[model samples]
Target: MSKPIFERDPSDPERQKINPALKLLLELGPLLVFFFGNARGEWIAERLPALAGIGGPIFIATALFMVATVIALAVSWALTRSLPIMPLVSGIVVLVFGALTLWLQDELFIKLKPTIINSIFGLLLLGGLLIFRVSLLRYVFDSAFNIDEEGWNKLTVRWGAYFLVMAVVNEIIWRNFSTDFWVAFKVWGFTPLAIAFTMAQMPLISRHSLDEEPAE
Candidate 1:
């Protein structure tokens, strides 16, 4: 079998681990790029006519969003030699939805991308837990923790529900708000909310930790 993506070298005392700080940058970097691209899209188009193909703020933003996401994913693959699951999934969605947005010249498609992605995750996590009788969350968090089966199950359920909640919130915001406001919320609002929720789970994580050494 192939080596696990998150596995650490056993004998390399000087080896570097993927720090949370860098992970945050890797994850949030593309969104920041997208916001900047959209906010400055007019100046960009005025300076570079080539970018005028995807004219207007939203279209230019969508195109640049795709580019930024692809760059982020490529950097992650280069650094780790393995794709992180969530980013991979999100990148794929960005490409597909962003393409449609550019092709159709409609901003709604890009605006609704997050709602669809989050809903799919909610279903996948919740349904997999029910059908497999095991928490699919383990695949992502296993590198960070050694929780028992029951703890894994509880965490998985919580995450699955959280995904659903996020989807609903995205739908409400994007549907009722202006595109620029939605874009700002997508970058600035959603991430902090997720971090807050994850932080709230730390006590539970510590309680369920297996008291084993982290792989390194």
Candidate 2:
């Protein structure tokens, strides 16, 4: 029996692979837009004046972020005919929270969006591991990497921990910091932290990697 199309590994021979750069862009594009938009929203609103209706810098940025997220998801779906699970989940949160932020003219909604997303993901991953005896990461990212069962379990645990930690960090930063600081951290700080953490997992990934194994 074959894996379902949705479960096909990203490295699977038959999948219509995206350019690696494009894939990265799709994943990070909306975030970059959000950060840039927030950082420059005042300047943007000043020139465009029409955007003044959006309320403030953070609100304008949230609006742009939502638009970018939608476009990214649409592009991914058009190319692959299936949305990647994690991005889809995140994008949905962005849209929902971003909308509330705009409609209410409140920045807290957008600020809390990351905290909520991370909490949900952490809980789901941990629940799947402890209660269901499964690595929930597989459901969201089976196609992104290949690992042995033990490696998958370890990787899932680490990611679950990381997600929860990130949730707490987001809460702390947003609650204590200025909006500009939060925006900067969201883009410049969190992105590098995530990248570094991913790099730190290279040993685990290589150790459990399926790519080098002989096919049956």
Candidate 3:
């Protein structure tokens, strides 16, 4: 039997590796589709006609977002023979909340999707570290970096806190702002913040990287 996703060793040489750029594109493609679908929902609905029944711009975007997310996950599974833990979890939430949004014609469910996903991730990471003394982040990112245990602990804390903060940020944005603004922030704002935060962790990763050369 195939190993569970969380148990699979990302660093294992036997695992098929996706190109970094393609991997990123796969991850971001759905969000881009969500943004565009919302922005041009009427244009798209006019052409497709079928999507008109889905309701407004946000609802239309939610439907397209669900399809895109499924496609991304399918591609990932096809290439890697296993789903990625983080994206897989996020995709499940997208499908669930997206369905609720469509069936009820309520935008609130879709709006709350990010907040829910981020909060779950944040709590999982934090709980693992604080209660179990384990760095769960290591499993998710082990393929990307070869940091030592100490580095993993520190990275876990930072990422856990970051996820929680993002959850709160998502709540604030969707609650206070217009739908367009929320969608834009989801695509533009959240992406940049995550990228910047990841970049900022490079020094910590480098410092604890097992691949680093020994001092002369």
Best by TM-score: 3
RMSD (CA, Å), candidate 3 to true, equals 2.1
Q: What is the TM-score of each candidate against the true structure?
A: 0.85, 0.87, 0.92
Sorting all predicted structures by TM-score, with the top scorer first, yields: 3, 2, 1
Clashing pairs in 3: none
Instruction: Answer with 1 or 3, whichever has the higher TM-score.
Output: 3
Error of 3 at 97 (Å): 0.5
Model 3 per-residue lDDT at 29: 100
For each candidate, the alpha-carbon lDDT, in order, equals 0.81, 0.85, 0.90
Candidate 2: regions farther than 4 A off: 1-17, 139-144, 213-216
- Regions of model 1 farther than 4 Å from truth: 1-17, 212-216
Give a tens-digit lDDT track for model 1, residues 1-216. Answer: 764564234233433346656767888888888888888899889988999887698898889889988988787777766667767888899999999999989888898889988888888889988997867676566546677777888898899999999999999998898888898998889999988998888888878877788789
TM-score attained by model 2: 0.87
C-alpha positional error of residue 119 in candidate 3 after TM-score superposition, expressed in Å: 0.4
lDDT of 3: 0.90
Order the candidates by lDDT, highest first — what do you get? 3, 2, 1
Per-residue lDDT tens digits for candidate 2, residues 12-35, read 566555566788899889999998
